[model samples]
Target: MKKWIMLSFLLIYLAGCQPFMGGQAVIDWVDFIQWNGQEYNGVHNSEIADASFIEKEIGEVRFKVADNVSNPSYQLKDGDAAFHEKGTKLYSIKGKDNIIAVKDEAAINGYRIYFAMDNSKYKWHFDDVSLEQVKKIEIYKSATPAGNQQIATIEDKAGIENFLEILSNSKEAPAFQPNTSTGDPISYQIILYTDEPITYKYSVHYDGNTYFWYPSETAILSDDIQHFISEK
Candidate 1:
């Protein structure tokens, strides 16, 4: 068996820039692979409906392995994103209500992305996943940045403090003002905080979909947060 090792820091983000204090983050899409040659019917909840029998219930996420008759460690192709290094398989997953990106690179490498169910509060399980009837997976999109939207960054604590100070002083931060780009009034703020002994610093992220907030201990990834970032 070719044991897979995790890749760290696919992308990093600024903790201060995020708006939320504590919450879940979502991305647009994620990618994975299937060994067999197959086509997607674009069916709604096709995986979920099929695996209803062995479904493991978390708060909101329901997981069940369909059938693992196929071979393990099948290789997948990485597309334009350069997300996966060569010789990687990707796993993909989707959100029931909204399409959130999967941050797990292992799953992503195998063309699979894992989603967390906050409300369900139960950790998901894929211990006995079967890969039959599934084949030819493609990552049409990513949960992080799309074409027009950009993923910005911040580096040091002083930077975060300065950004926050600017927001507090000007009141022109996205949260208080109308964004000129999309013209959407800043609904929330994204706060990214690094390791600090005394004070907590933050930034303002005004993106339409995500309300990110990386705490003192966490790291900001390419919107995916969990799978794409590394904390030191």
Candidate 2:
């Protein structure tokens, strides 16, 4: 009787400590598919894939495994922007909700070029000067109380242009499956201000792999953009 009682207690303890015990547990999808071939043979059945048991035991386990996998670092190229200097403050206007003051010459020029190209008003603005003219560029968020949210800083004019081009091409879409551990989607708000007190707001979001913008239907972040943000 004592032996049976102890066995019951052991089982209870294991169940209570399942999370810790199953921390490293993972489901082999390839093996699972092979074994349950008939179930998923012809039709696209998500019953097993979206099962709560599978999510808790296997899906969550896969997420943990992915977390352990180290992502490759982004490589820097010959004209990539350097990290911003410490204590740099982003300027904000008094009455404007999203207006910001841009002092960096290169960033100012880049914005002008971006706006001109976006409106199709003046394609010749960039024709006069080469991208090599701009040495460095940086973007900062004006929403924070301290106004010190520096998003990205790039030194290569070509890199900045590429970034702008991506922004100009993105289009809006409905939300997709998010890959975050918290199960919440990641979002970004890019605010740009011009001397005319004009404000441009761009909304970007991450679907685990890449960052996409809504308006232009473009992917602003590729390997290079990822590297730039990560490096900073």
Candidate 3:
């Protein structure tokens, strides 16, 4: 009777702890996560099902218990990276590694910093056309006290080049999205008129801190550009 009771107790204990043991404790999903005091957000991933292990092995992400999690799944802990739906926490990603590609079929393609060992690739890709080819840019605001309105129109060549320079230096975010949950979103409508037959339309999204080209994967507004636009 004693032997049988001991066996039953052991089985019950094992069953209770089973779900927590998957060889590795990876969360099912997380919007974003804080690691080593830095925030990585706006995660995008390509699901290569049954994909071969990546050999690039850029960096590693270690999950630790924390008090705050902007995204629910992230607060739970998992890989080192944060993304939207299919972001994976990679302990060791393959490549120069850690920077994830964000591709938009409509306008542009860019990259986001993900689990980076250092802040190297965290700048906008700003494939802006040559300044000489640019004619002017018209700026507008969407959420305003007077409703959407034209804010400024920049036709000066020097001003346009200055804006483009600042944009190139703007910092790249790990994971970023337009957050309108608080106040009215800080947004701008940028219609760039160029010499080419194509007139490019971009956005200026201010998250109370920095500005981003909302539809883009990684285009942040520059300070000089911000000032330049403000003056206009």
Candidate 4:
């Protein structure tokens, strides 16, 4: 997984620059997402939503006049007029409510561009999950060599019911923020199979003190789920 680029700099406003902070920053970055079939590398996604779940848009953005495009890893300013890179995926999470414009080299390889928003513009509504319809549950945990390896698989009726109950009770959290921080929180992935051809995916994140599902839905992992992590 690509860690988000954290550019920490004191804002230095300059004359003739855009109204916002447009001074020459001491730090910068330039990278595109590299998708290798199964995984997206070199970019840290702002949301936990899978690529299939997002509303993607494409467009080009000219470099700001003050930005030195020659610098490989310099930070771009979204001050007033223009942004830095050509946007590949302008992800609209909730019908344009919470939109994120990504600058990636999707034409060549995947590149990751970062944008920050202060808040999510919409409240999300998830479809009701039916426990009986879930045929199987695959649980994966973080590791060194394998990265994310299967820790447990649930096929029994009782086990599936318990897991879903825990998931349903998850508390909501603040989902979106425009942060350029380098910290990557630890997370787990769950792939639930149902009677239908469609599959369900959920992410469990441990943000130091609390464990919640990413995108504002999370709870304490049940002992059954935690046991899988412990044993693995």
Against the true structure, what is each candidate's TM-score? Answer: 0.20, 0.32, 0.40, 0.41
Could you arrange the candidates by lDDT from highest to lowest? Answer: 3, 4, 2, 1
| Total clashing pairs for each candidate | 41, 11, 11, 15
lDDT of 4 by residue, 130-163 (tens): 5677777777665436466667888888888787
* Residue 48, candidate 3: alpha-carbon lDDT: 15
**Model 4 TM-score?**
0.41
Which candidate number has the best lDDT? 3
lDDT by residue for model 1 (165-200), tens = 333333212333323576542322122322211111
Which scores higher on TM-score, 2 or 3?
3
- TM for candidate 2 is 0.32
Which segments of candidate 4 are over 4 A away from where they belong?
A: 1-128, 142-144, 173-184, 207-209, 215-224
lDDT of 2 by residue, 92-173 (tens): 3344322222234333222111111112332122222233333444555433554435677655657767766555455444
lDDT of all the models against the reference? Answer: 0.26, 0.33, 0.46, 0.45
Residue 13 of model 3, lDDT score: 24
- Return the TM-score for candidate 1, rounded to 2 decimals: 0.20
Question: Where in model 3 is the C-alpha error above 4 Å?
Answer: 1-128, 143-148, 177-181, 214-216
